[model samples]
Target: MSNNSILLIDPNFDPANSANLSLLVKIGADTFSYVIIDQERKFVHAVYDEQECEDGYEKLKERLKNDTYLNLKYETVKIATHTQNVVYVPQELFNENEIALYTKFFADADSQNIYVQPSLQQNIYTVFSLPYSIEKIVNHNWQQSIKLEQNAGLLELAVQFDKETLIIDFTVGSFQFVYIKNNNIAFNQNYQFEDTEELTYFILLIVNQLNINMKQVAVNVCGIINDGDNKWSLLTQYFDKVEILTLVSDLDTTILDDMPAHYYTSLLALQTCG
Candidate 1:
């Protein structure tokens, strides 16, 4: 199957679309294309399907003949593409800490590998892709580590008991979620969301259903929708404690504004562990 990915074309080039052209060479992606969506959602430039790849430098130059404005603005066409590729991770390559984190993350899923991500913008931990067998082992061990982290003040302590840790993620369109538990007792549920409004009611429903005090709860927000102050300030109405978390530091600022959040997250994740 063709991989689904997002491409970021050079802001300078109009017709060269050379950025996309170059990616086709490096990744050998099955399909290639570009869509320029303005604030008005108007198409400024575009190419799709078979027309995605370029013939050669000469041909690419010819295509940009009409892109005189871009010619004056930039020297070369640079583009960024987000594509999926089968990634492999040897079990022994990861430590018990990393494996434990993934186990708590995957819970009941069965997958060979896991995607370990740390967000630069939000500086939060994200674990994706895990096999069921490893997940159980990791989760089991994570509970033990969590007890240590909490006692050592590494984890949120206010709601470390029977209550749940409410996660309101505003990172992407569709958020991924998971519940971390301690035996039969469930202590936390991570709620991933593109924006708070989309799942605001659901959060309230859960709070009411669980009969949580909300004030004693901890809320973690990520992405552009919720700012450092707003992430905690607004949630203060419902949560006793609220904090903003990011896996990246100030040095990683460039990538945050330059790339899409998910792409940035994946790249940052790779960079940190590498």
Candidate 2:
């Protein structure tokens, strides 16, 4: 990891606990974050770093080579940028050949850079991907791995609660909005924002497009935000019930005493995908 990277390690972390370690690496456009969980599903150590695309991958490779805890039995690689596409296909009608058709939704079908991941949800398949750089780096490290739906972590949050839910996962230059109604995914989209006004505009645009009753739907937010930040205040103007996302009830979060739990919610929820 770079010298500027922010890292947090639980005081109780022990190398002997490697047998139960599970790592999650989330690569985004301008930043990357990772979380390590122990056998008992407790947060062991985590890191969040800001770097250019190529530099971030190089740092990750360096970390993998030197970080003792990363040599664990299980790891999950998640690409969290907007470079990919998400298409819902009926389970019975889906086929490997159709993967190319879905790729066309976001990119040229002939592009070699495209990769597809189909996650089954009852009767539908949520197909998503990792960009070529992300795919190359992750595959080079872990030959056998799973491609997580970009919204999988958010979906985990949505299902755990019984309400019309909207989750906004914020990062450096981008953010993702996920809406769940009646325990099913209604909409999921990512956007780039230059300021709070642009961000608020997009949020209201989605709200109007979805015909969501702002007063009734509960908005749960996560990722790099705080109580009195401009983004938080803007969101409050539209949502009366806006609140930080709740961590999964089972994990031990005592190690996160100094940081807002919402900031690492997505990283922690990634484990639920397993």
Question: What is the number of backbone collisions in each predicted candidate, taken in the order shown?
Answer: 11, 0
Q: What C-alpha lDDT values do all the predictions have?
A: 0.33, 0.67
Candidate 2 backbone collisions, by pair:
none
Query: What's the lDDT for residue 206 in model 1?
Result: 66
> Please, what are the lDDT tens digits per residue for candidate 2 over residues 82-135?
344567665576777767677667542333444444332443456665556656
Candidate 1: tens digits of C-alpha lDDT, residues 170-268? 323332221223311223233333355746665676667766666665554433334434434546766777665343433323313543342222122
